[model samples]
Target: MSSTSKPSSSENIVAQKFDRCLADLIVKSGVGFSAGVIASVILFRRRAWPVALGTGFGAGMAYADCDRSFNPARIPGTRIIPASELKKDGSS
Candidate 1:
């Protein structure tokens, strides 16, 4: 038996997404860490927990965004619609 099927586009590795993901991870985590440092100095008496918490939150957010980019269906309040549903006049 032989099957001729085109490879799925989703399987393709996109360089742009990787670059964006890396940038987001760096920027967001850095921002979170900075914010935590400020908060620690101003309110938390320079404790370490705040910094760690902030970094974790930033990383989690980045992970969510990356996941959504890789699989759009994982995004909240989003759904996948088949091409048939997009037709205006009920024609394929």
Candidate 2:
């Protein structure tokens, strides 16, 4: 059997998923942080910290909603199997 035919380890799959999730989170956080900076620096010169915090919270909520909208399995109480596994089962 060739090495390419071997199934990937679960640890590798998990690590990949973790990396993807972290990357998504960082991008989302940056967008939120930028919005916060804009609002604090431009609109509300005083109380910048509070405004930034509030906007950041709003951004986080938006991110959660957006994430759920994109991936239905992200909702609570649901099992999320990767598409590759489904394909392996001939279900796709």
Candidate 3:
């Protein structure tokens, strides 16, 4: 007999989803940070603070956007809107 309890199928599915979301967040943040760094270097040389600030901001935005899309949660009185929520009838 096994000593450890095996996870159910539903639990496994949830875990897999969580893992996928985490991977997406990491990839998106990395790409965004790299792009920001390159842009900062091209736009402003010798600006260490700007480069760091831009990288952080870009990465944060990328992560938030990915989260919003992947795990959408309806929030009241929030200005931020997901792209998928937009309707063709011109109604929010």
Note the Cα lDDT for every prediction shown: 0.85, 0.71, 0.66
Global local distance difference test of model 3: 0.66
Best by TM-score: 1
lDDT of 2 by residue, 1-92 (tens): 66577677988866776676666667766776777787777877854684558556755776686667557788999997889898999964
Query: What lDDT does model 2 reach?
Result: 0.71
Off by over 4 Å in 2: 1-5, 50-92
lDDT per residue for candidate 3 within 1-92, as digits (tens), equals 68897767977767777786677667766766676677768877746765567557756765676566555563335575567666643573
Rate residue 40 of model 1 by lDDT: 93
lDDT (tens digit, per residue) of candidate 1 on 41-62: 9999999989998888888888
Give candidate 3 misplaced runs (Cα > 4 Å): 1-8, 49-92
**Which segments of model 1 are wrong by more than 4 Å?**
1-13, 83-92
Candidate 1, residue 20: the lDDT equals: 89
RMSD of each: 7.5, 7.3, 10.6
Reference-based TM-score of each model: 0.73, 0.52, 0.49
lDDT of 1: 0.85
Clashes of 2: 0
Candidate 2 lowest-lDDT run of ten: 46-55
